[model samples]
Structure formats: structure tokens, C-alpha cells
Target: MNRLAYHQGIHKFFMMLGLALHISKPVWKHLVHLVDALTTKRFSGTLTDVHHWSFHPNHRTTLSHFFTKSPWNEERLLEKLQEWVLRQIERLAKRTNQPLFLSIDDTICQKTKPSSRATHVIQGCDWHYSHKDHQMVWGHSLIWLMVHTFTQAFPFAFRLYDKKAETSKMDLAIEMLSSLKGKRARPVYVLMDSWYPSRNSSKPA
Candidate 1:
């Protein structure tokens, strides 16, 4: 295929992802542009970078507004994404007669410590231990659940570790896993480090 056709195909695939979610046409249009920009080779991973790489006619400010004020429901989008991913992975597992894998892990999104004089810091930013840095760092911790097969993997869900909620990372992991209780079509294994498997969490629920 020619370069333009290949790019168009990729964008079309992204557009199809939201079709089942019942999002507005404008939101769908913006989503394709954003996905295209993000998946571009050498993407710098910023909205401005998206503006530079995107072929859509909307201005960067319009894209920014889409994020801040768009009527699309993010939770619905995630739910539909999970539904689509589950369908795909289940088909692969059943076809190959392979067991599915559910992997749970947490990572810190490091952030700069605000100055004492500063009135407010980013909401949800706090100190979290980073195994990679081997020290406590100021950031938000995210718990992620991924589904893996012998051939491929997909991020299934995620939760931000909320300190004020009085919920531990293990609890968040369990909650996400619980969401998959009756959803799997094959034998599934849960993978995690020693840090997450408590007496309660270790048991099959």
C-alpha cells in the first residue's frame, strides 16, 4: 500500500474502535486525529506534538477543547474498550487453546514537588515509592491490569491509587480483577509481584 493509504487505514481502524461506544461524530473525528498523532512514528507524546503531526483540520486549541469540554463519556469509552479487548483476546485464546493471563502492576507518574509558597499542587499528587528509583518520589501511583496471551497483550484497565480513599493498592488490584469475574472465556492466571499477594488477595475469589 502507498504511505497515504497505510496512514488512512490506521486512522480508520482507530475510528472503528469508537463506533460501538455511541460517541458523537465530532468526538469520533477528534479521537481519530488524536490516535493518529499519538501513534505516529517519533511522536513526542504531547498535545502540541499531536497538533504538529495530525492531518485533521482542527486547530490545536480545538483539540485541547475536545479534551476539556467534549461531551463524550470517558468511562463509557473505557468500558467499551475493555469489552472489545475481551472479545478479541477470548477469541484468540479459544482458537489457540491457550490460557489467558491477567497481570497487575503499579507504576508511579513522577511529578515535581511544588514549592512551599505555592498555594496548590496537582490534585492526587503525593509521595509514592518507586522501585525503579529505589526511593520515595512525589507522584501519582497507577495500578494497571493487562490481559496477555502467548502472542499479544492488551491493557485492560487501570485505577489511580487514592490515598484519601483509604484503599490500598492491593484492594484496587482486587477490585479491577473482580470486574473480570465472569468475563473470561478461558482459564486465567493472575500475575503479580510478591508485594501484592496478601493472605486475602492470594486466595481465588
Candidate 2:
């Protein structure tokens, strides 16, 4: 089967298992389209099509709209996704009899201009030597935490920190660890690069 079909099948299965409800089939289909667009890096086309298709007469309103208009929040959806991921990891741990490894790192998504929505304001710094430009350019920093899955060799669980804040990447890593704590029987080993080495700037974890 094709990728789109596989995604649709999984969506149907989840719906049948009662894990996804209150979301119409059409909205779900659009959401799958959105995911495909994101995966394929077709951002402009996807945004245009989503905006056009969403307002059509036959298209149903998305869950995001309802939640924003009503009292519902994203916490429940996030919790469900987390639970599903943990369950999958548990199954893998039982099958392999090995501990799970998580990697934490941070990078800069450089932006030339500032926006009002950005939070945690902090001064930009240049961590790399630009040989081509002969000068370093300051940019905002982003921290991420990743998990290595049994099905995939690479790390997942990447979180982006776009805001300019005083919070250390270590703090974010600890929060992610705390969330996954007690969720598995096997051990979890977190790896970090030299940028995240034990430092006086932040207390040891």
C-alpha cells in the first residue's frame, strides 16, 4: 500500500479502537493531507490548499477551531499521544530486553527579524566559527530532546525552543525525563553533546 493509504488505514483503525472520536472523517482526511505536506516539505502548497479546502462548504471544521472557540485544551491530546508512544516503547523493551536511549541537544534556527509572539527574550550568541563569512552571526537557540526507538535507529522526541529565554537546555531535558519517569520498567539513558556538558551555568542533573 501507498503511504497515504497506510496513514488512512491507521487513522481508521485508531477510530475503530475509540482512540479518536469527535473528529469527522473529512477533517481527519485533511489532517492526513496536512501531515503528508509537512513530511514532504511542501509548506507553501500545503498551507494554500489547507486554507482553501478548510473553508469550503463540504469541508468540516477542524478540531483546532473548536478547541479555540470552546473551553477545550490541547493537554488531553498531548497526553494521549504521549501514552501511545510510551506503550509502543514498552512493547519494544519487552521484546528486545534492552534499555531505551534518549539524546538531548540544542540548535539555532536563525531568524533575521524579531516578532512579537516570541517569548523568553535573551541575547543571541555565535557558537560557531564562520570560515566563509569570517565573522559570526548571532541567532536564537533551540533545545531538543530525542528518543531512539526500536523500529528506528535514529532519535525522536525533538522539541524546538524558539523563544529567547534564560532557561537552560538542561532544564528542558530534565522536564522531558520527568515526564517519562516511571512509565517504563527498563532503564533510560540520556546522551548529550559537549555543549551540554556539566557546567556551573546550570546545576548538575
Provide TM-scores for the models: 0.83, 0.61
Candidate 2 segments exceeding 4 Å error = 1-7, 13-30, 44-46, 49-72, 111-140, 149-164, 195-197, 202-205
Candidate 2 lDDT over residue span 1-205, tens digit each = 1464656665765564444564565545555555554445335543455444333233335534632454433455455566666666767876888687777776554444445586754455433323344654346455566565555434334444433455666676667667765655788777887646566565221
Q: After superposition, how far is residue 34 of candidate 2 from its true place, in Å?
A: 2.1
Error of 2 at 82 (Å): 1.9
Residue-level lDDT of model 1, residues 113-188, one tens digit each, is 8999999998998887777888888988899999989898999999998767768888899899988857566998
Taking all chains together, the TM-score of candidate 1 against the true structure is 0.83
Weakest lDDT window of 10 consecutive positions for candidate 2:
51-60
